[model samples]
Target: MPVRVVDSSAPSQVSGANPSHTSPPACTLLSVGQAFSGTQNVSSLQKDEAWRVNVRIQGCDLDHGYLCGTMEALNVPMADTPWVIQVVTFWEGEIVDMKNYTFFTGKWEATVGKPFPLMVVLSIVNRSEVDTRHWTKFPSFSPLLSQVEVDGGRSLDLSNYPYIFMRWKEQYFVNVGTDCGLTIAGFYYVCFSCSDGSINGFYYDPNSSPFQKLELKITNEGRSGFSFSSYELQ
Candidate 1:
């Protein structure tokens, strides 16, 4: 099936999770794409029959000298075919979350000190002739590491962050391809806001606890998808 990638143009919220209290910082959406492989063409399905999937960001802590957040997938369709979705952190080479069925969707969170790329991989197979559509969205990181100046004049590198990190819960969709095959469509959002907040504490007593009041908002303008199997950071 022919695959298409789209990026979002929303802004990132850089404050505490309270959106009603303050407006999120303006952020540019990044380009996103999906990777797939197989002999069957899956893009012939109808648009209304397509599934919608998304990942929602529940929490994040870049100020406590580490990066941590909660996430979950929503509105994924159940399939008799073998299907699985998982969160993999490249910095630690760890699978943060994994699910085999659509009913197994819920909240998952993680924290890490090392800056590296992360990703979420989904594997699905529909043996039935009937067309199926499902939508889904997941949190993702660009896997591209850049030098970021944290508070307190400390410099950190996220060059190795997972090319894809679905650490937070979001939205999504999956649908039938044009060839009467199952088409898997989804989105990936990227950001570089994970950090350890020694910078916020520099203004306070050095011996005191690090100030943990800063928030990091990461945003992208589109979505990306990937094929089943293992993916690595370059």
Candidate 2:
């Protein structure tokens, strides 16, 4: 699916100070949301509802910037072959004021089974300042089957059970199982801070808006394995 951007501007509000000779704002290196694109197809095993996400960058000095995020659904039908669903980085738009900068946002969906789970990742970089800090939060996925492994010399039941793995920031990894699942389905608030080597700071505000809520569901798609049925964030 394509990338979507959300507008997060409120009544004129100010929070931080701007330094002399300010550099351009940071660029969004990556962003991934499970609730982007409304609803997406993952092979033919199962279908899942979409989640909602909103991202805002406040307290910075820059007029224009770039950002991108991607989400992938993995299905491992066999030890040697696997299926993947992915969304990558794309430009959202330009920023005019740091006090009221809300640029990136969207929703997405997917389908999966036992051998795989949903994975999301996001990354941002500030080019204007040597040091920077930003706050971000999105919905987390809970896997139906938590852990599995494949050995070359061992005989395994490949048809009855599948394996899944999710990686974020290329450092953290999560295993999906039958017990774990996403806990929420709404927007989260974050704070960002940046400065040259002489000055730097960061802040993150928890989501307090009344419109934030979570909804989740699981379905049996009648395939050889289980599948995600529906999900909504409103």
Candidate 3:
């Protein structure tokens, strides 16, 4: 697949989160992909309740799946938000909180020293079961990092921040309190603004603890636990 840079066109405000509770994820039909190795952990909420997640990909065939990238992790856990999707396109290594956007691929480009777009396919589930969600498309999105100044308009570098791990309390990882950063008056550029042009979920504090480390896991006898002993700075 040839890499192409997207134009300045704005992202179309589309629907998000499949509402059907029993439907399989969109990634299932991409390849002959079944649940490739997954890990389960006891929930921090219900003692008897457990959370299971899996990382599915087309192995060596990046050309096979609609959402082609290095990694695509998805799962349905009976939590506040029952469905979760994480996708990384060829150019962007990782996209945090992808569930927050209405679909905004037009925001990234290699011309700006960033990664280019790739063959994209999204079979996303609907409706977040969370009490408070960051899915608001426009005006309500957070702007925490978009306000930062870059030399000659460089694309944001997500590698410097910690990756979002759904295994934790979910809240602590994706939640950046409304007051965590500054918001430019007219620009509505705040610390947690989702206006980063990718998805509606880019708001964050760079130096914050939750954004400091990647998720670590250990597997044994069909169970995986957060490996607290392992953490590497992004």
Q: Highest lDDT: which candidate?
A: 3
For TM-score, candidate 1 versus 2, the one ahead is 1
- What lDDT tens digits, residue by residue, belong to model 3 across residues 31-122? 22222223222232324322233322222121211121122223323124444333222111112222322122222120122221223232
Predictions ranked by TM-score, top down? 3, 1, 2
Q: How high is the lDDT of residue 76 in model 1?
A: 27
Candidate 3 stretches greater than 4 Å from native: 1-48, 59-155, 159-234
Indicate the TM-score of model 3. Answer: 0.20
Compared with the true structure, what per-residue lDDT tens digits does model 2 show for residues 1-234?
111122222222111212221223332211122122122221212333333322211112233222212222222222233532222211122221222222122111111111111132122121111111121222110121111121110122211112111111111112332122221222222112222111111111122122122221211222121112321211
Where does the lowest 10-residue lDDT sum fall in candidate 1? 197-206
lDDT of each: 0.20, 0.20, 0.21
Q: lDDT per residue, candidate 1, 44-109, as tens digits?
A: 234322222222221222221112222222232334435533221111011111111111112121
Candidate 2 wrongly placed segments (more than 4 Å): 1-62, 73-234
